[model samples]
Target: MQMHQTARNDLLLDVRNLETHFFGEDSVTRALGGISFQVKKGETLGVVGESGCGKSVTALSILRLLPKVSARTVGGEVRFHGRDLLDLSDREMRKIRGDQIAMIFQEPMTSLNPVYTVGRQIAEAVQIHTKASRSAAMKKAEEMLRLVRIADPERRVNNYPHEMSGGMRQRAMIAMALACSPELLIADEPTTALDVTIQAQILRLIVDLKERTGTAVMFITHDLGVVAETCQRVIVMYAGRIVEQANVIDLFARPAHPYTQGLMRSVPDRRRGRQRRLPEIPGIVPSLREPIVGCSFAPRCPFAIDICREKRPPFLDVGSSHAAACWRAEEVMGA
Candidate 1:
């Protein structure tokens, strides 16, 4: 009763059947096909899939950052704190973007302004959202640099984006995103370009900062290892749609969807010891430019049946708090 109502109230971001499309000369790429999910307060929700699976698109669309001319959110509602973001004007969306919700984009090198100093850039975000004075925002920026564990923050704040190392720039991005203490932070492959050691450090820093700020994080990455390490729950997307949703343990233990199982098999298992080659998912991913007739993964799924190619499977609960969009979910899980 009371707890249930409280839980509902805790739903920070609710995306309902979000449909996004990119128009071209003669084709329409269905970038996001009515995908829906929820991000609760202070939880790290991972959205993962191979490239072109709409993970990044989902983040951009939720924040209304997609291009205006070609790309449009054709349908759906992105409700943040019970207010639909889709209905907000551009000015209103801008306010919400850095203040209430911040995002760390894929590439820090390009995402950060080359001409602006790191601290100035961070302070700009703070000033926009907090309306702080120049000196005060600069101070806040230095504090954020320290918060992200950047050494010599006082000196580093004056450094331009190009002057810093890849990982350092990424840390700066995180700092900027957190300067306002946003309620939800969307990170799109923030560690993809860093070295193994740097990647580990960034991941730890994000987890630490997220805990310290009590900010809900929507981590979008193709790395299952990162998801397993940082996220409590994850959504597996395929061809712009969610194929499975489960907690880290359940998903790794018992993958209910064939596509998910394939992805798991593709990951290197050190326990198995040297193999000739890693197992691969057969066939290429479907092109989103055309309408998919049935289950998008049917062509590549080994467990796919005739029905899989004939009809789209509903996203259904397979076990407690675990769901998959597969008709053969039980069989796949058991096997």
Candidate 2:
């Protein structure tokens, strides 16, 4: 998030005031509420928040992958390469997806076609995007599998989704996403399903692959540990909006938002005795179905003042390139 001598052209993706809602028979659920951020070219940007905080929804919204029947993005612009993605025709959008901006979904089993070999799926993407010959695309697929460090690319490419282990499947997913070498890679909880050891391996693999490919990444996860290991910049979302955005190091060292402080406190502290219960944020997340009168996190924030409960706070500058939507960021950071 550091903007030291940063130019506007350095941005690979620029999202402005994005808002997404899901409509039901009775009421509408506000999934994303005017959240905005940027991803610099070749930098790994992490979006971390608790479940239902619009982390996944942000990714989906950016890709235009949300369910059409229910979810709708009512406002805002998703700009990539100086073009507004929301205004693109479906055909144009299709061409851009997987070629210009690719996404690796959370669950490989659900995403990977059960009927097709892993190789075919990857080759299909290459073929569709690049229009390469079947043989050439298959060759590219094999090369991608090798790139992701999948053992025996020759044999593994022919294996079905079920045939590969969880880690392998996730790797294959990454390979498919990177097959065409997209400029922006959106990985939505890519390591959520894998075991701890496998999770570490996957995280390492993503970092290595991003460096090798020079691809910018939007990594969405609930784990701050993953963010610390992989991201240069971090966006902390709460109640459908970004509460704080800062460099990963600064975010950990001085969390200016009370919600961010609460989240950090919830992380297990090795220095603390085992008998000490993990700290938690005090109140339930505000319901998004109804209108939020003030700061959505004020109900749970320990530093809330009268104005925090009466009127929403604007994003205040905590430092260079660090901002938080909090009335008492100074007190929160010192606390």
Candidate 3:
């Protein structure tokens, strides 16, 4: 198979050959192994993978938040607005963080400071990024709470994170993330801990806010259902590398990569039949203690060939802006 270039479009954030490694006592684990993707202005790039697939690491690398003393970005470049984030000084990176880019973490309980009231937490972000006075910031925090569809914003703002329910805490986190009007928002499983009804509400709130603010979002989740509802484009990661990427509709309609196919097949479809059992991918995800020598998914891939055991496959364009990294690309396409 030959490499094909997809149509070039304006990109808001571009990550190229990103490699984040964590040094342990006996071995160095490669958390992210040369992963690359881009997010366009007013677009949501949904990154989906099983747990421990380097999804969260990619997010932290972009923000330069990984502990540099032990965790190192040994290679690659992360460019935001044409500036290389890896080259930026700590002070410079701090300015970009929360101002140009913001993150809504998975668990609001752990992400939020327990001692601070929700209003004060949001206000701190506002005051740090914008030249808002304490009173003004507090007022804006209340407005932000209202914008996120939280009822009784004035009362909620004064409550600490532990005082609110799970759904309310998630909303407060969203309010705080959007306090500075960031151009890019990285939502790392923001709805994971919420109930079904609240999850849908939060997803809709994110969509509405993005439409209003024109903020580019990197939404990371293990749920394909969430991707279907929230994303425009989807990137499927496996064992630290992107295995498949396509528009949301195309990805669901025709997943070219075997791993992606397995993921789609695994989603429970109760409408199919009462006897339908969810398909599961067998075997465990490979440890990244050492450099991967071959196609990372080869061990679990149903169609893997001999060549797949010895060599890593380059990402090949399947069709219509879709790409997949697999040695048996032709087999996947039935060529």
Candidate 4:
């Protein structure tokens, strides 16, 4: 796939043909199948798809954070600033991981430690990454809390994870992730658990932080609306592969892949009066254990033809920096 064409200097991350799998006793689940994309400096790249589309796996693979017992990165390279992370030793990868490339998970409750105060956790990251004393790191932690727009940052820093509200805890998580001023941040549905108002607040905080720090962001979410508001470019993944990618404006205006089109149609239109049913894509996602022939989404695609069932389509460039992995890309775009 011709996944990226980033200039040498502007690119911060270039993930190429990454494949990750989970090995059980009798079965192997292909979680990521040759997914490729690039994140430029100070850019926000959105990866949108339904559940089980390998969005989380891709993030985990990049950080080499998957459980050693079951998950294994079988093939492909994750290039971060021209260095292949997969080739790095565990000790080397650990140094790069929070200090250079950080991640904010979906649930702050699970990610944060109940035993320690929020400030201590953030300070720990700073101390590990830099040669700062405990007191200095703790002060930096308070600064991080204030940077994220948390109220009473001095007092809030001393509070435990369970003591804060959901929004506060999420903001704390962001502060912890941004403690070291990472070059690239992977936010996996960071606002998924927040209320609409809180979600907007967190989104704004992330955007503002990105602008202030010039850090590239890899935003992984199923919310197209969130993508519209935050991302400059977006890639639509389906069944472990990128089915389409384009600029956010072009993607929303003219989605070239069948899956992308279905996702766009599924969004509710408030202008249309109350409807009996909102549009939905039919059929459940197929299991990854099953051998997939041709296109993985062919069975669920409305535009699937004989060739779609028999042969997998290549990722074809559809113009204007857009690409789609579909046999009927021209027909779908009405070109």
Candidate 5:
């Protein structure tokens, strides 16, 4: 993959050849197969792929929040602020998890503690990370609620997650995640469940907050439309590895990878006639448990050749900063 020179000095998070796996009694699942990417300061980078394509795993790996019993980071480095996070002690990682790096999970309902008021939960995080007094922490929590544009924050902060509407609860989650002014925020499909209007509002709120705080963001989602709108650069993942990476504009204009092209075609086009059916990718993602010698996406690729099915392709730069993991990328893109 092509490494931009600017990333050498500007990146806030640099993940290099990171690999992760989940072990069971009888089988092992390769959750992340040598994934690499960088998130520059105050920039939003999108990681898009179908479900089970290692998007969430990459996030969890960066934070070292994977399940202790089954999952392990086998190789590579996750460097943040020039320090390799994989070398940090548990106590050390604890300090950075919320203070410098935070994550907003997909579902607020399941993530927020059901028994405690939202205020208490956010306050507790502040106290734990900053050593603030309980009263001071609560005050900060209310300010965070207001920052997220929650109405009547003074009263709403006291409401439990279940007491608030879905959008409000999601806002509260964002409030908690940003309470410490993290330099890097990993948002995993933060707006996937919201209504269209609410989704737009949340996206706007995130973009606004990032601008105000100058915080870099790694936004993970399967939505291409969201990527085009929210991210400056996009990484298209497939079968636990990245197949393409490029600036959003270039990617939309010319997707070099077959998988990336297929994803773009699958997006519903309002410009087309009303009776038209959106194009669909031919096959489901392969199970990670099965060994793949060739390109993992070859089974579904329309232009797959004999070599494509027999040998894995290296991720190579096609032109400029655009990179793709297909042997025939030039032909596919030009066609």
Candidate 6:
């Protein structure tokens, strides 16, 4: 995988020092802990991490959709098109959401309304964002469904969500997301609930849509293979913070963070001779209730040193547009 230079001026969204916290029974859980990254126009940025690593939370924060009573965006900035989304009013944010930014969630069954026909759902989005009438919106919805490669979209649009298969439902969700031709799309584990074949189809559809619409995407998932196939760059997160950021090729070839290396090794490879057991990263993720004293990954990092345990590592630039937050990044690369 050869690294290519991304057009720096094409950056569409830049998130800086974002922090989202949840108030629980007795403590506050920091879901997004000072995370930062950028998604360029017409490029896909994949975010990979284990469950509960703030992948979904980060996506929700960008839309300002977190439950206000229990969760709040504590700090940081989410800039889209040189405007800070955090400063926008609720009404303004609502207009931006689904019009400028749309999201395709992991589960289409739950995300889609059970009582409404797929066509009606997509038409609703179109009508809300654009000045299209009922008949016009429905026509646009049908076109979008066909665009997502759904067969007999006109008929399918009339069918309720429960009548469609998991794959078809996912495609319907995608059609709804693209109803307004949004500038940015956030897909959180879009294919997680589907089979392998369906997952591949969904990934291909997203790539095709990006190529055709020049829509920037923030694809959140734990599957590295999917990232390799779909994303231009990768952001590795752990304990709510981004630990490494690099172009897809470089990150896969020479991962900078020890935790990232561990994750790569843990992926089962048939090329390797049969092993007694798959590799596993030791230790559980640290509790986010209390403020972390040092690097959150230090507890599980095999090459962690005294310095790593005593202080948080700054995101160090290793090369052009490649960076990692690890004290022993060089040593990890060597290994």
TM-score to native of every candidate shown: 0.97, 0.97, 0.95, 0.96, 0.95, 0.96
State the lDDT at 231 in candidate 6: 93
* Superposition error at 260 for model 4 (Å): 0.8
- Winner on lDDT (3 vs 6): 6
Per-residue lDDT over 1-335 for candidate 1, one digit per residue giving the tens place of the 0 to 100 score: 45744769879999999999999989999999999999999999999999999999999999999988899999999989888999999999999998999999878999999999999999999989887999999999999999888999999999999899999999999999999999999999999999999999999999988888899999999999999999999999999999999999999999999999989888888875676588789999999998998899999988889999999999999989899999999999998
Alpha-carbon lDDT of model 1: 0.94
lDDT (tens digit, per residue) of candidate 2 on 58-161: 99898899999999999999989878899999899999999999999889999999999999999999999986999999999999999999999999989999
Superposed by TM-score, candidate 1 places the C-alpha of residue 109 at a distance from the truth, in angstroms, of 1.2
Q: Write the per-residue lDDT of candidate 3 for residues 1-335, one digit (tens) a residue.
A: 01211344467788999999999888899889998899998899999999999999999999989986789998999988767899999999999999989999989999999999999999999999889999999999999999998899999999999999999999999999999989899999999888899999999999999999999999999999999999999999988889999999988887889999888877778765567778788898999996777899888888888889899999989897999998786677562
For model 6, the run of ten residues with the poorest summed lDDT: 1-10
| Candidate closer to the true structure by TM-score (higher is better), 1 or 3 | 1
Tell me which residue pairs clash in candidate 6: none
RMSD in angstroms between candidate 5 and the native structure over all alpha carbons: 2.5
What TM-score does candidate 4 reach? Answer: 0.96
What are the Cα lDDT values of the candidates? 0.94, 0.93, 0.90, 0.93, 0.93, 0.92
TM-score of structure candidate 5: 0.95
Residues 149-177 of candidate 4 have per-residue lDDT tens digits of 99999999899999999999999999999
Best by lDDT: 1
